[model samples]
Target: MCRFLEELGVAHHSAGAWHWTSDTYPADAISLRAVTSDNFVVVDITNEEKVIAEVAFPAALLELHEKAIYLHEARQYQVEKMDYPQRKAFVRQVECDYFTDAIDYTQVKILEEFETCPLGAARAAHGEVRVNRQIVGFKKVKFYTNENVGAGALSLPEQEMHTTSFWLHFPDPFLARFSDLTPTEKLNSISGMGNALRTVAALLLMCDPRDFGVSLTEEIRPGLEGFEPNLHLYDSYPGGIGLSAPLYELRPRLLAGALDLIRGCPCEEGCPSCVGPAGETGARAKDGATRILAALVEAGLESGAAPQK
Candidate 1:
């Protein structure tokens, strides 16, 4: 490790220990957490050009976008301008009764597949993927009632990321069982299943929910058709942080746990603890997700694909 650091011109080996080579403090140059290292600065332009807070890169698209409501220390600020080139957001204090939730469109393409297994009619795999995401708009929801009072459109540049992911591809034979479901319903089902997987993965990994991200897509790659839709759980960091491989290994346990979580939930439709909030995930999301997970579990059991430690 010291040799690698020395090669990077950051450290030197002397007296059986590694020492900083530069006059500047090494700690000052290094960020403790890789995910939060590249961040955007928020400036308050109401009174003066005062630095208010900092937002991480992944979150800046949703939290610091133009017209977005940013909450800090229990106070609310409205983002008036977002200068992506400058890596800064100009916001002003505002008294509003609602908050904002950004709506984004994401596409994931497999860059390289590391490991794969056939679980019944579905294929589970872990690999590197390139994610293309664009924040299209946001909804203004009232504070207490959680009512979406309004929404606005946004035109911003797309953000691309390379990360490691654990994904499930439902083959056409498996999806045939859902022939009665419309395309929207299928999409909703995938969304719900993805949410459940994210929750269960976090629990199994003993990590925070924010450490992983979920995405459901009909097209795993561009122009691909007749293939199964994909539900992905990716490490939410640049270059990843050793999460996807473990998740791939625990695929069976993850699916079974997700099934248990959804089946045991008390909500009739769906809640945050299960699939997702009913308002966003559709009315039949929980039911569809339950059925999908049950099928996955059943297939794994029939094939005797036990989780490998």
Candidate 2:
């Protein structure tokens, strides 16, 4: 930082500290959220159009997309149109049996690692990560039954953020245990394990599930041993909400809770309560996730690590 300022001729070195030589207040340039001050305004177009709510840039890509059902004060409002350039969403009140849930694809790149350790064969770590997400579609889920009633495609620009995340990665030795399963099934298991972990993590952290986002990727190598699949639980907000660091410390409890939840679920294969809806994930997602979690726990015990404290 000091070198950058000096290179720009705005700061000078004196008394072993950098002194600002420019007239600007650098604090004003710093922002807590990794975004501009612009926000998308939701306008109620039912009777006479009136401003209803405001959504941040990153969230607007998913929430303010055309055909999305926007909920405000327990009232359902279906988005009719979105003016991308103007950052406004036109919505009208409607009675509907379901709400919209956006489906997005996320990619995480590790920016910096804060801590890392082995939990049996798998490794656990927490760090700053760059998250890029694109909302490709949405699902309309029925209110009472929680069923996926319908879906529609979306075309929106991707959103990116730098946030803190807690991740668990599996190496080649761990992957060897699941060699009997097909490639797709292994990927599905990774996805299912991520889903279960996100739920249990929220419970352990005493925060709403929405506070964090989950993703599965084979791009990161925190262990530096090789490329491996890593399941990440990240803070949803830009920058961070200071959640991942504590979650890293509670790794053992999080894994245990997720395993217990999956094991105790009454559904024979899988359900939203455990791994995921049966067919959506693989047929054996429950078994796969259970095996992975149990192995992780048992490996920890055998090596005297047993996850983390």
Best by lDDT: 1
**Per-model TM against the reference:** 0.91, 0.79
Q: Mind giving the per-residue lDDT tens digits that candidate 2 earns over 1-309?
A: 889889999899999987999898877776555445677999999999899898877778878899999989999999999999999999999999998999999999988888888976778899999999999899999998889999999978788889999998888778788877776777788789888888898899888887889888776444565547888899998889899988987877788889999999999879988899887897988888898899887766666653333
Q: 14-42, model 1: which lDDT tens digit per residue?
A: 88988888777867867765556789999
Q: Every model's Cα RMSD, please?
A: 2.5, 6.4
Alpha carbon lDDT of residue 199, candidate 1? 89
RMSD of 1: 2.5
| Alpha-carbon RMSD, candidate 2 | 6.4
Candidate 2: worst 10 consecutive residues by lDDT? 300-309
Clashing pairs in 1: none
Which ten contiguous residues of candidate 1 have the minimum total lDDT?
218-227
Regions of candidate 1 where Cα sits further than 4 Å from its true position: 6-22, 33-36, 220-227, 306-309
